[model samples]
Target: MTRRVLLALLLLGLAAGLVGAAAWAYEAWRDRVLEEGDRRGEARVQARWDEDRARAQEAALDKARQDAAETLRRLNQQQENERAQQALLAQLARDRDAARAAADGLRLRAAAYLDAAGCGHLAGDSALGCVREAAAEIGIALSRSAQIAQRVAADADEARSRGLRCEADYDALTLRLSML
Candidate 1:
């Protein structure tokens, strides 16, 4: 009976040691699982933040591209307008030069007429001579009138050109404002 009791006591001690070791291993496994779950959660949060930042950058880039395109379009329109204005001014200059040449021709013809009429050689104040002098005076008056009319016409044309230029500038300014 003494030997049997000692064997039973040893068996009980071994069973207790086994139970303790199993509990310790279970606790270690649980701790590792919890730590892995926390790391995964942090990675998900960081990914969301990076995605949000990328989307914001993309939106800003799109807006910048739109603004650049609009600016380029406006510049092209302005350059085209300038070219048209230059062409109109050149044409106006050519027309003015042609008109001046015609006026000069008319002036030369009037001078020739006066020379042919010979009113300056008035011989004795006869009625015929008076008539000739009167006709020459009328021709001189008509030439002076033509010169005055030409000057007035030139001034009117200049004013018209200036007004057209001012109107075009105003239209350009309004167009730019509307685009903005």
Candidate 2:
């Protein structure tokens, strides 16, 4: 009976040792599995961070491009406005010169009329008719000057209102030439 009991004790010890070895192996494998899972999770997080960073960079670049385009457009607008202003100023100067010339011509014409009207007692009807015609011519010339001046003033007002710097030179030129 002692021998039988010793054999049974040895068998039980061997079984326990086997179970402990198996349990140790299972724990090692479980720890490795958990570590691998953690590594995978960290890699997934890093990928998401990289993607978000790329998206943010893209958004910033897009905003910068838009800002640059807007700036360029504003600069172009300024240049265009400056050119238009110069054009208008040139037109105004020409109009003023022409207006002066027209006035001078009118003055010379009046002098000629005066010289002709100075001949008294040459035929009362002819003398009176000459004076009347001269007066009508002078009136027409004066009226034309006033009309041209008014139109120029109106054009200036319109330019100011519309923030434009372009004038119609032909219209003013026509009025001045008519007086001449």
Candidate 3:
């Protein structure tokens, strides 16, 4: 081939190589920009997801707090009911004890009355067997009366110690209970 033709062909080949290199560099730059944009888009989506998760967690926390408050309220109500029941029980017990004490006092008084009707100091008199029997009954009645009086006094003392006073003080505590 001619030298001039060969030189012209070499120049054309160099120009083609330059164009190819330029095209390859352009593609590489475009790919890098696209990768950067994809990374930025992924970061934005992740940030939005994190925000949504935080909001859901906050909502759950709020619900838990509400549930806890409700539980506390229910517990308080139950405790109040228990306290009321205990108070009622204590009052009933006090009433029952007062009634029993009053009954004892009345029984003692009745026995003493029966003895006064016939028995008393004439227990040794054999002329009237009935009178002797009455005297023995009187002795038993007096003893029981003393015991009842002691019990009544103790009950009044106990009531006072508990900060609950009986009417008429310690002496007539059972008498007031009998009226009730």
TM-score of each: 0.56, 0.62, 0.54
Q: Which residue pairs clash in candidate 2?
A: none
Comparison by TM-score, 1 against 3, better one: 1
User: What is candidate 3's lDDT per residue for 1-180, written digit by digit as tens?
Assistant: 688889989988999999999999999999999999999999999999999999999999998997686566556655665565457556656765776677667666765765676544555556556765655566577557756865776566555534422222332324333654
* Candidate 3 lDDT (Cα, 0 to 1): 0.67
Model 2, runs deviating above 4 Å: 119-162, 165-180
Query: lDDT per residue, candidate 1, 111-151, as tens digits?
Result: 57655766445545576577667766766776677678767
Quote the lDDT for 148 in model 3.
Answer: 80
For model 2, state the Cα shift of residue 77 in Å. Answer: 2.9
Which of the two candidates, 2 or 3, achieves a greater TM-score against the reference?
2
* Residue-by-residue lDDT tens digits, candidate 2, 57-145: 99999989976866665566566766766776677667766876777677667656665766233435876768766666776778677
Worst 10 residues of 2 by lDDT: 165-174
- lDDT for every model? 0.74, 0.71, 0.67
lDDT for model 1 comes to 0.74
Worst 10 residues of 1 by lDDT: 114-123
Best by lDDT: 1
Error of 2 at 29 (Å): 1.4
